[model samples]
Target: MYGPGDVRVEEVPDPTIDEPTDAVVRVTYASVCGSDLHPYRSMAPSQNGRRMGHEAVGVVEEVGADVTALTVGDTVIVPFSWSDNTCVYCREGFNTSCVHGGFFDGAPSATQAERLRVPQADGTAVVIPEGTDESLMPSLLTLADVYLTGYHAAYTGGVSPGKTVTVIGDGAVGLLTVLAARQVGAERIILMGRHTDRTDLGREFGADDVVPERGEEGIAKVMELTGGDGSHVVVDAVGHLPAYEQAYGVLRPGGTISRVGVPQYEEAPVGMASLFGKNATLTGGPAAQRRYLEAALPQVLAGQIQPGRVFDRRLGLDDIVEAYRLMDSREALKVLIRP
Candidate 1:
């Protein structure tokens, strides 16, 4: 990304193993994340463009001497963030907070390109079994970030049997959160989104109700659906202040609000009425995707869930600008990039 609204596909040098723990991956699939839109909309211009994209699935082409878990020809899902998995935080299932961890976009090589130089390969990449069907690539790609992110929201929110979940936003993460909630056995799931196309998918993913309204009206609708008590958990997949407001508004007194969206605002009401009075918990951040990748991979491989359905459009690498435009304008829910 050069600056706001200017995304380009420029030729760059191929990557190579740069550290003892690093490996080079030939990207087979990559996608434009919603969070990428933040910098896409407001990032300052740069002399040298920022390396964009973090989600990817690829074949390991070369590995450093220390990379024991991966070898040449191995297919792997590169988590959006890289970490040395043996850190204390990683042992506790918080790979995103690993002492030596960093995000892919922060590295010199990013996943959007045809090749990526992955640091901490053994701990950051999940190796897929050999001979996996090519048709399942899209689903496997979700394990890199999207599906695990949704699961993170549900997991952090303490979503489980007998609880009611209200997912705010119908984007890929929100819809998948509905799926995640259902998988964890939530009794009811309510999706708040105005787009019928997306909400429809939410239902298929297990949302029992769709609240098309927003603000006070949306809150009221959700409250009514939950028998006037509000939901046990509210997953805010939209980072706007309004979405946070709706979360607290429709949350039951002791419920949790899990946010997976990249927040747009820094200040929010955590005051008496918004949170403290209800004793609600606010949690969620960059997903520890590596922690959940192993568990979710089987589900995708078995054809149990089609989280990849969130991708509504596909484009080649050269058309990346158009892909960004499609997603920014909401013309595409998500775009799959073939590089």
Candidate 2:
């Protein structure tokens, strides 16, 4: 990205193994994440464009001598960030906060390209079994960030059987949160979105209701749905302040608000009226993708869930700019990139 609204695809050098723990992956599938829109809309101009994209699934082309878990020719899911799996934070299910971890966005190589240099390969990449069906690639790619992120929101919100979950966006993450909430046993899933097509998918993913209204009206609709008691958990997939306000508004006393969307603003209400008096807990951050990948992978391989269905459009590498535009305009739910 060279500046806000300017995405240029220029040729760059291919990646190679750079460290003893690094591995080079030949990306087969990569996708534009909703979070990418943040920089797309407001990033400062730069002489050298930043590499975009973070979610990818690909084949390992080379591995460092010290990498024991992955070998050449292995297919792997590269999470949004890299980390040493043995680090204290990684062991505790917070790979994003690993002592030696960093995100792919500012790295020397990013997943949007045809190749990526993955640091800490053994700890960051999840190897897929050989001969897995190619059709599952999209689903597998979600394991890198989107699906796991939704799952993280529910996990942090303490979603469980007999609980009501209110997901505050109809984007891919929100739709998948509905799926994750259902998988984790949430009895009722309410989705807040204006788009019928996206909200329709949310319903297919197990949303019990969709609130097309916004602001106070939206909050009232959700509260009405919950019989004025509010929801047991509110997953804010949209990071703007309004989304956060809606989250608190519909949160049942003692319920949790989990925010998976990267926040666009820093200031928010945490005072008595918003949280303190209600004893509401605020949690969620960059997903522990490596940690959640373990459980989500098998389910995708088994065909029990098709989170990839969230992808509504497909574009080749050369059309990435259009892909971004489609998403920015809300014309595309999510776009799959074929490199």
- Write down the lDDT that model 1 would get: 0.92
Q: What TM-score, computed on C-alpha atoms, does each candidate reach?
A: 0.98, 0.99
TM-score of 2: 0.99
Clashes in candidate 2: how many? 0
For residues 117-201, could you state the per-residue lDDT of candidate 2 as single tens digits? 9999999999999999999989999999999999999999999999999999999999999999999999999999999999999
Best candidate (score: lDDT)? 2
lDDT of 1 by residue, 219-286 (tens): 99998888899999999998899999999999999899999998999999999989999999999998
Specify the poorest-scoring 10-residue window by lDDT in model 1: 99-108
Give the Å error, residue 213, model 2.
0.4
| The best candidate in terms of TM-score | 2
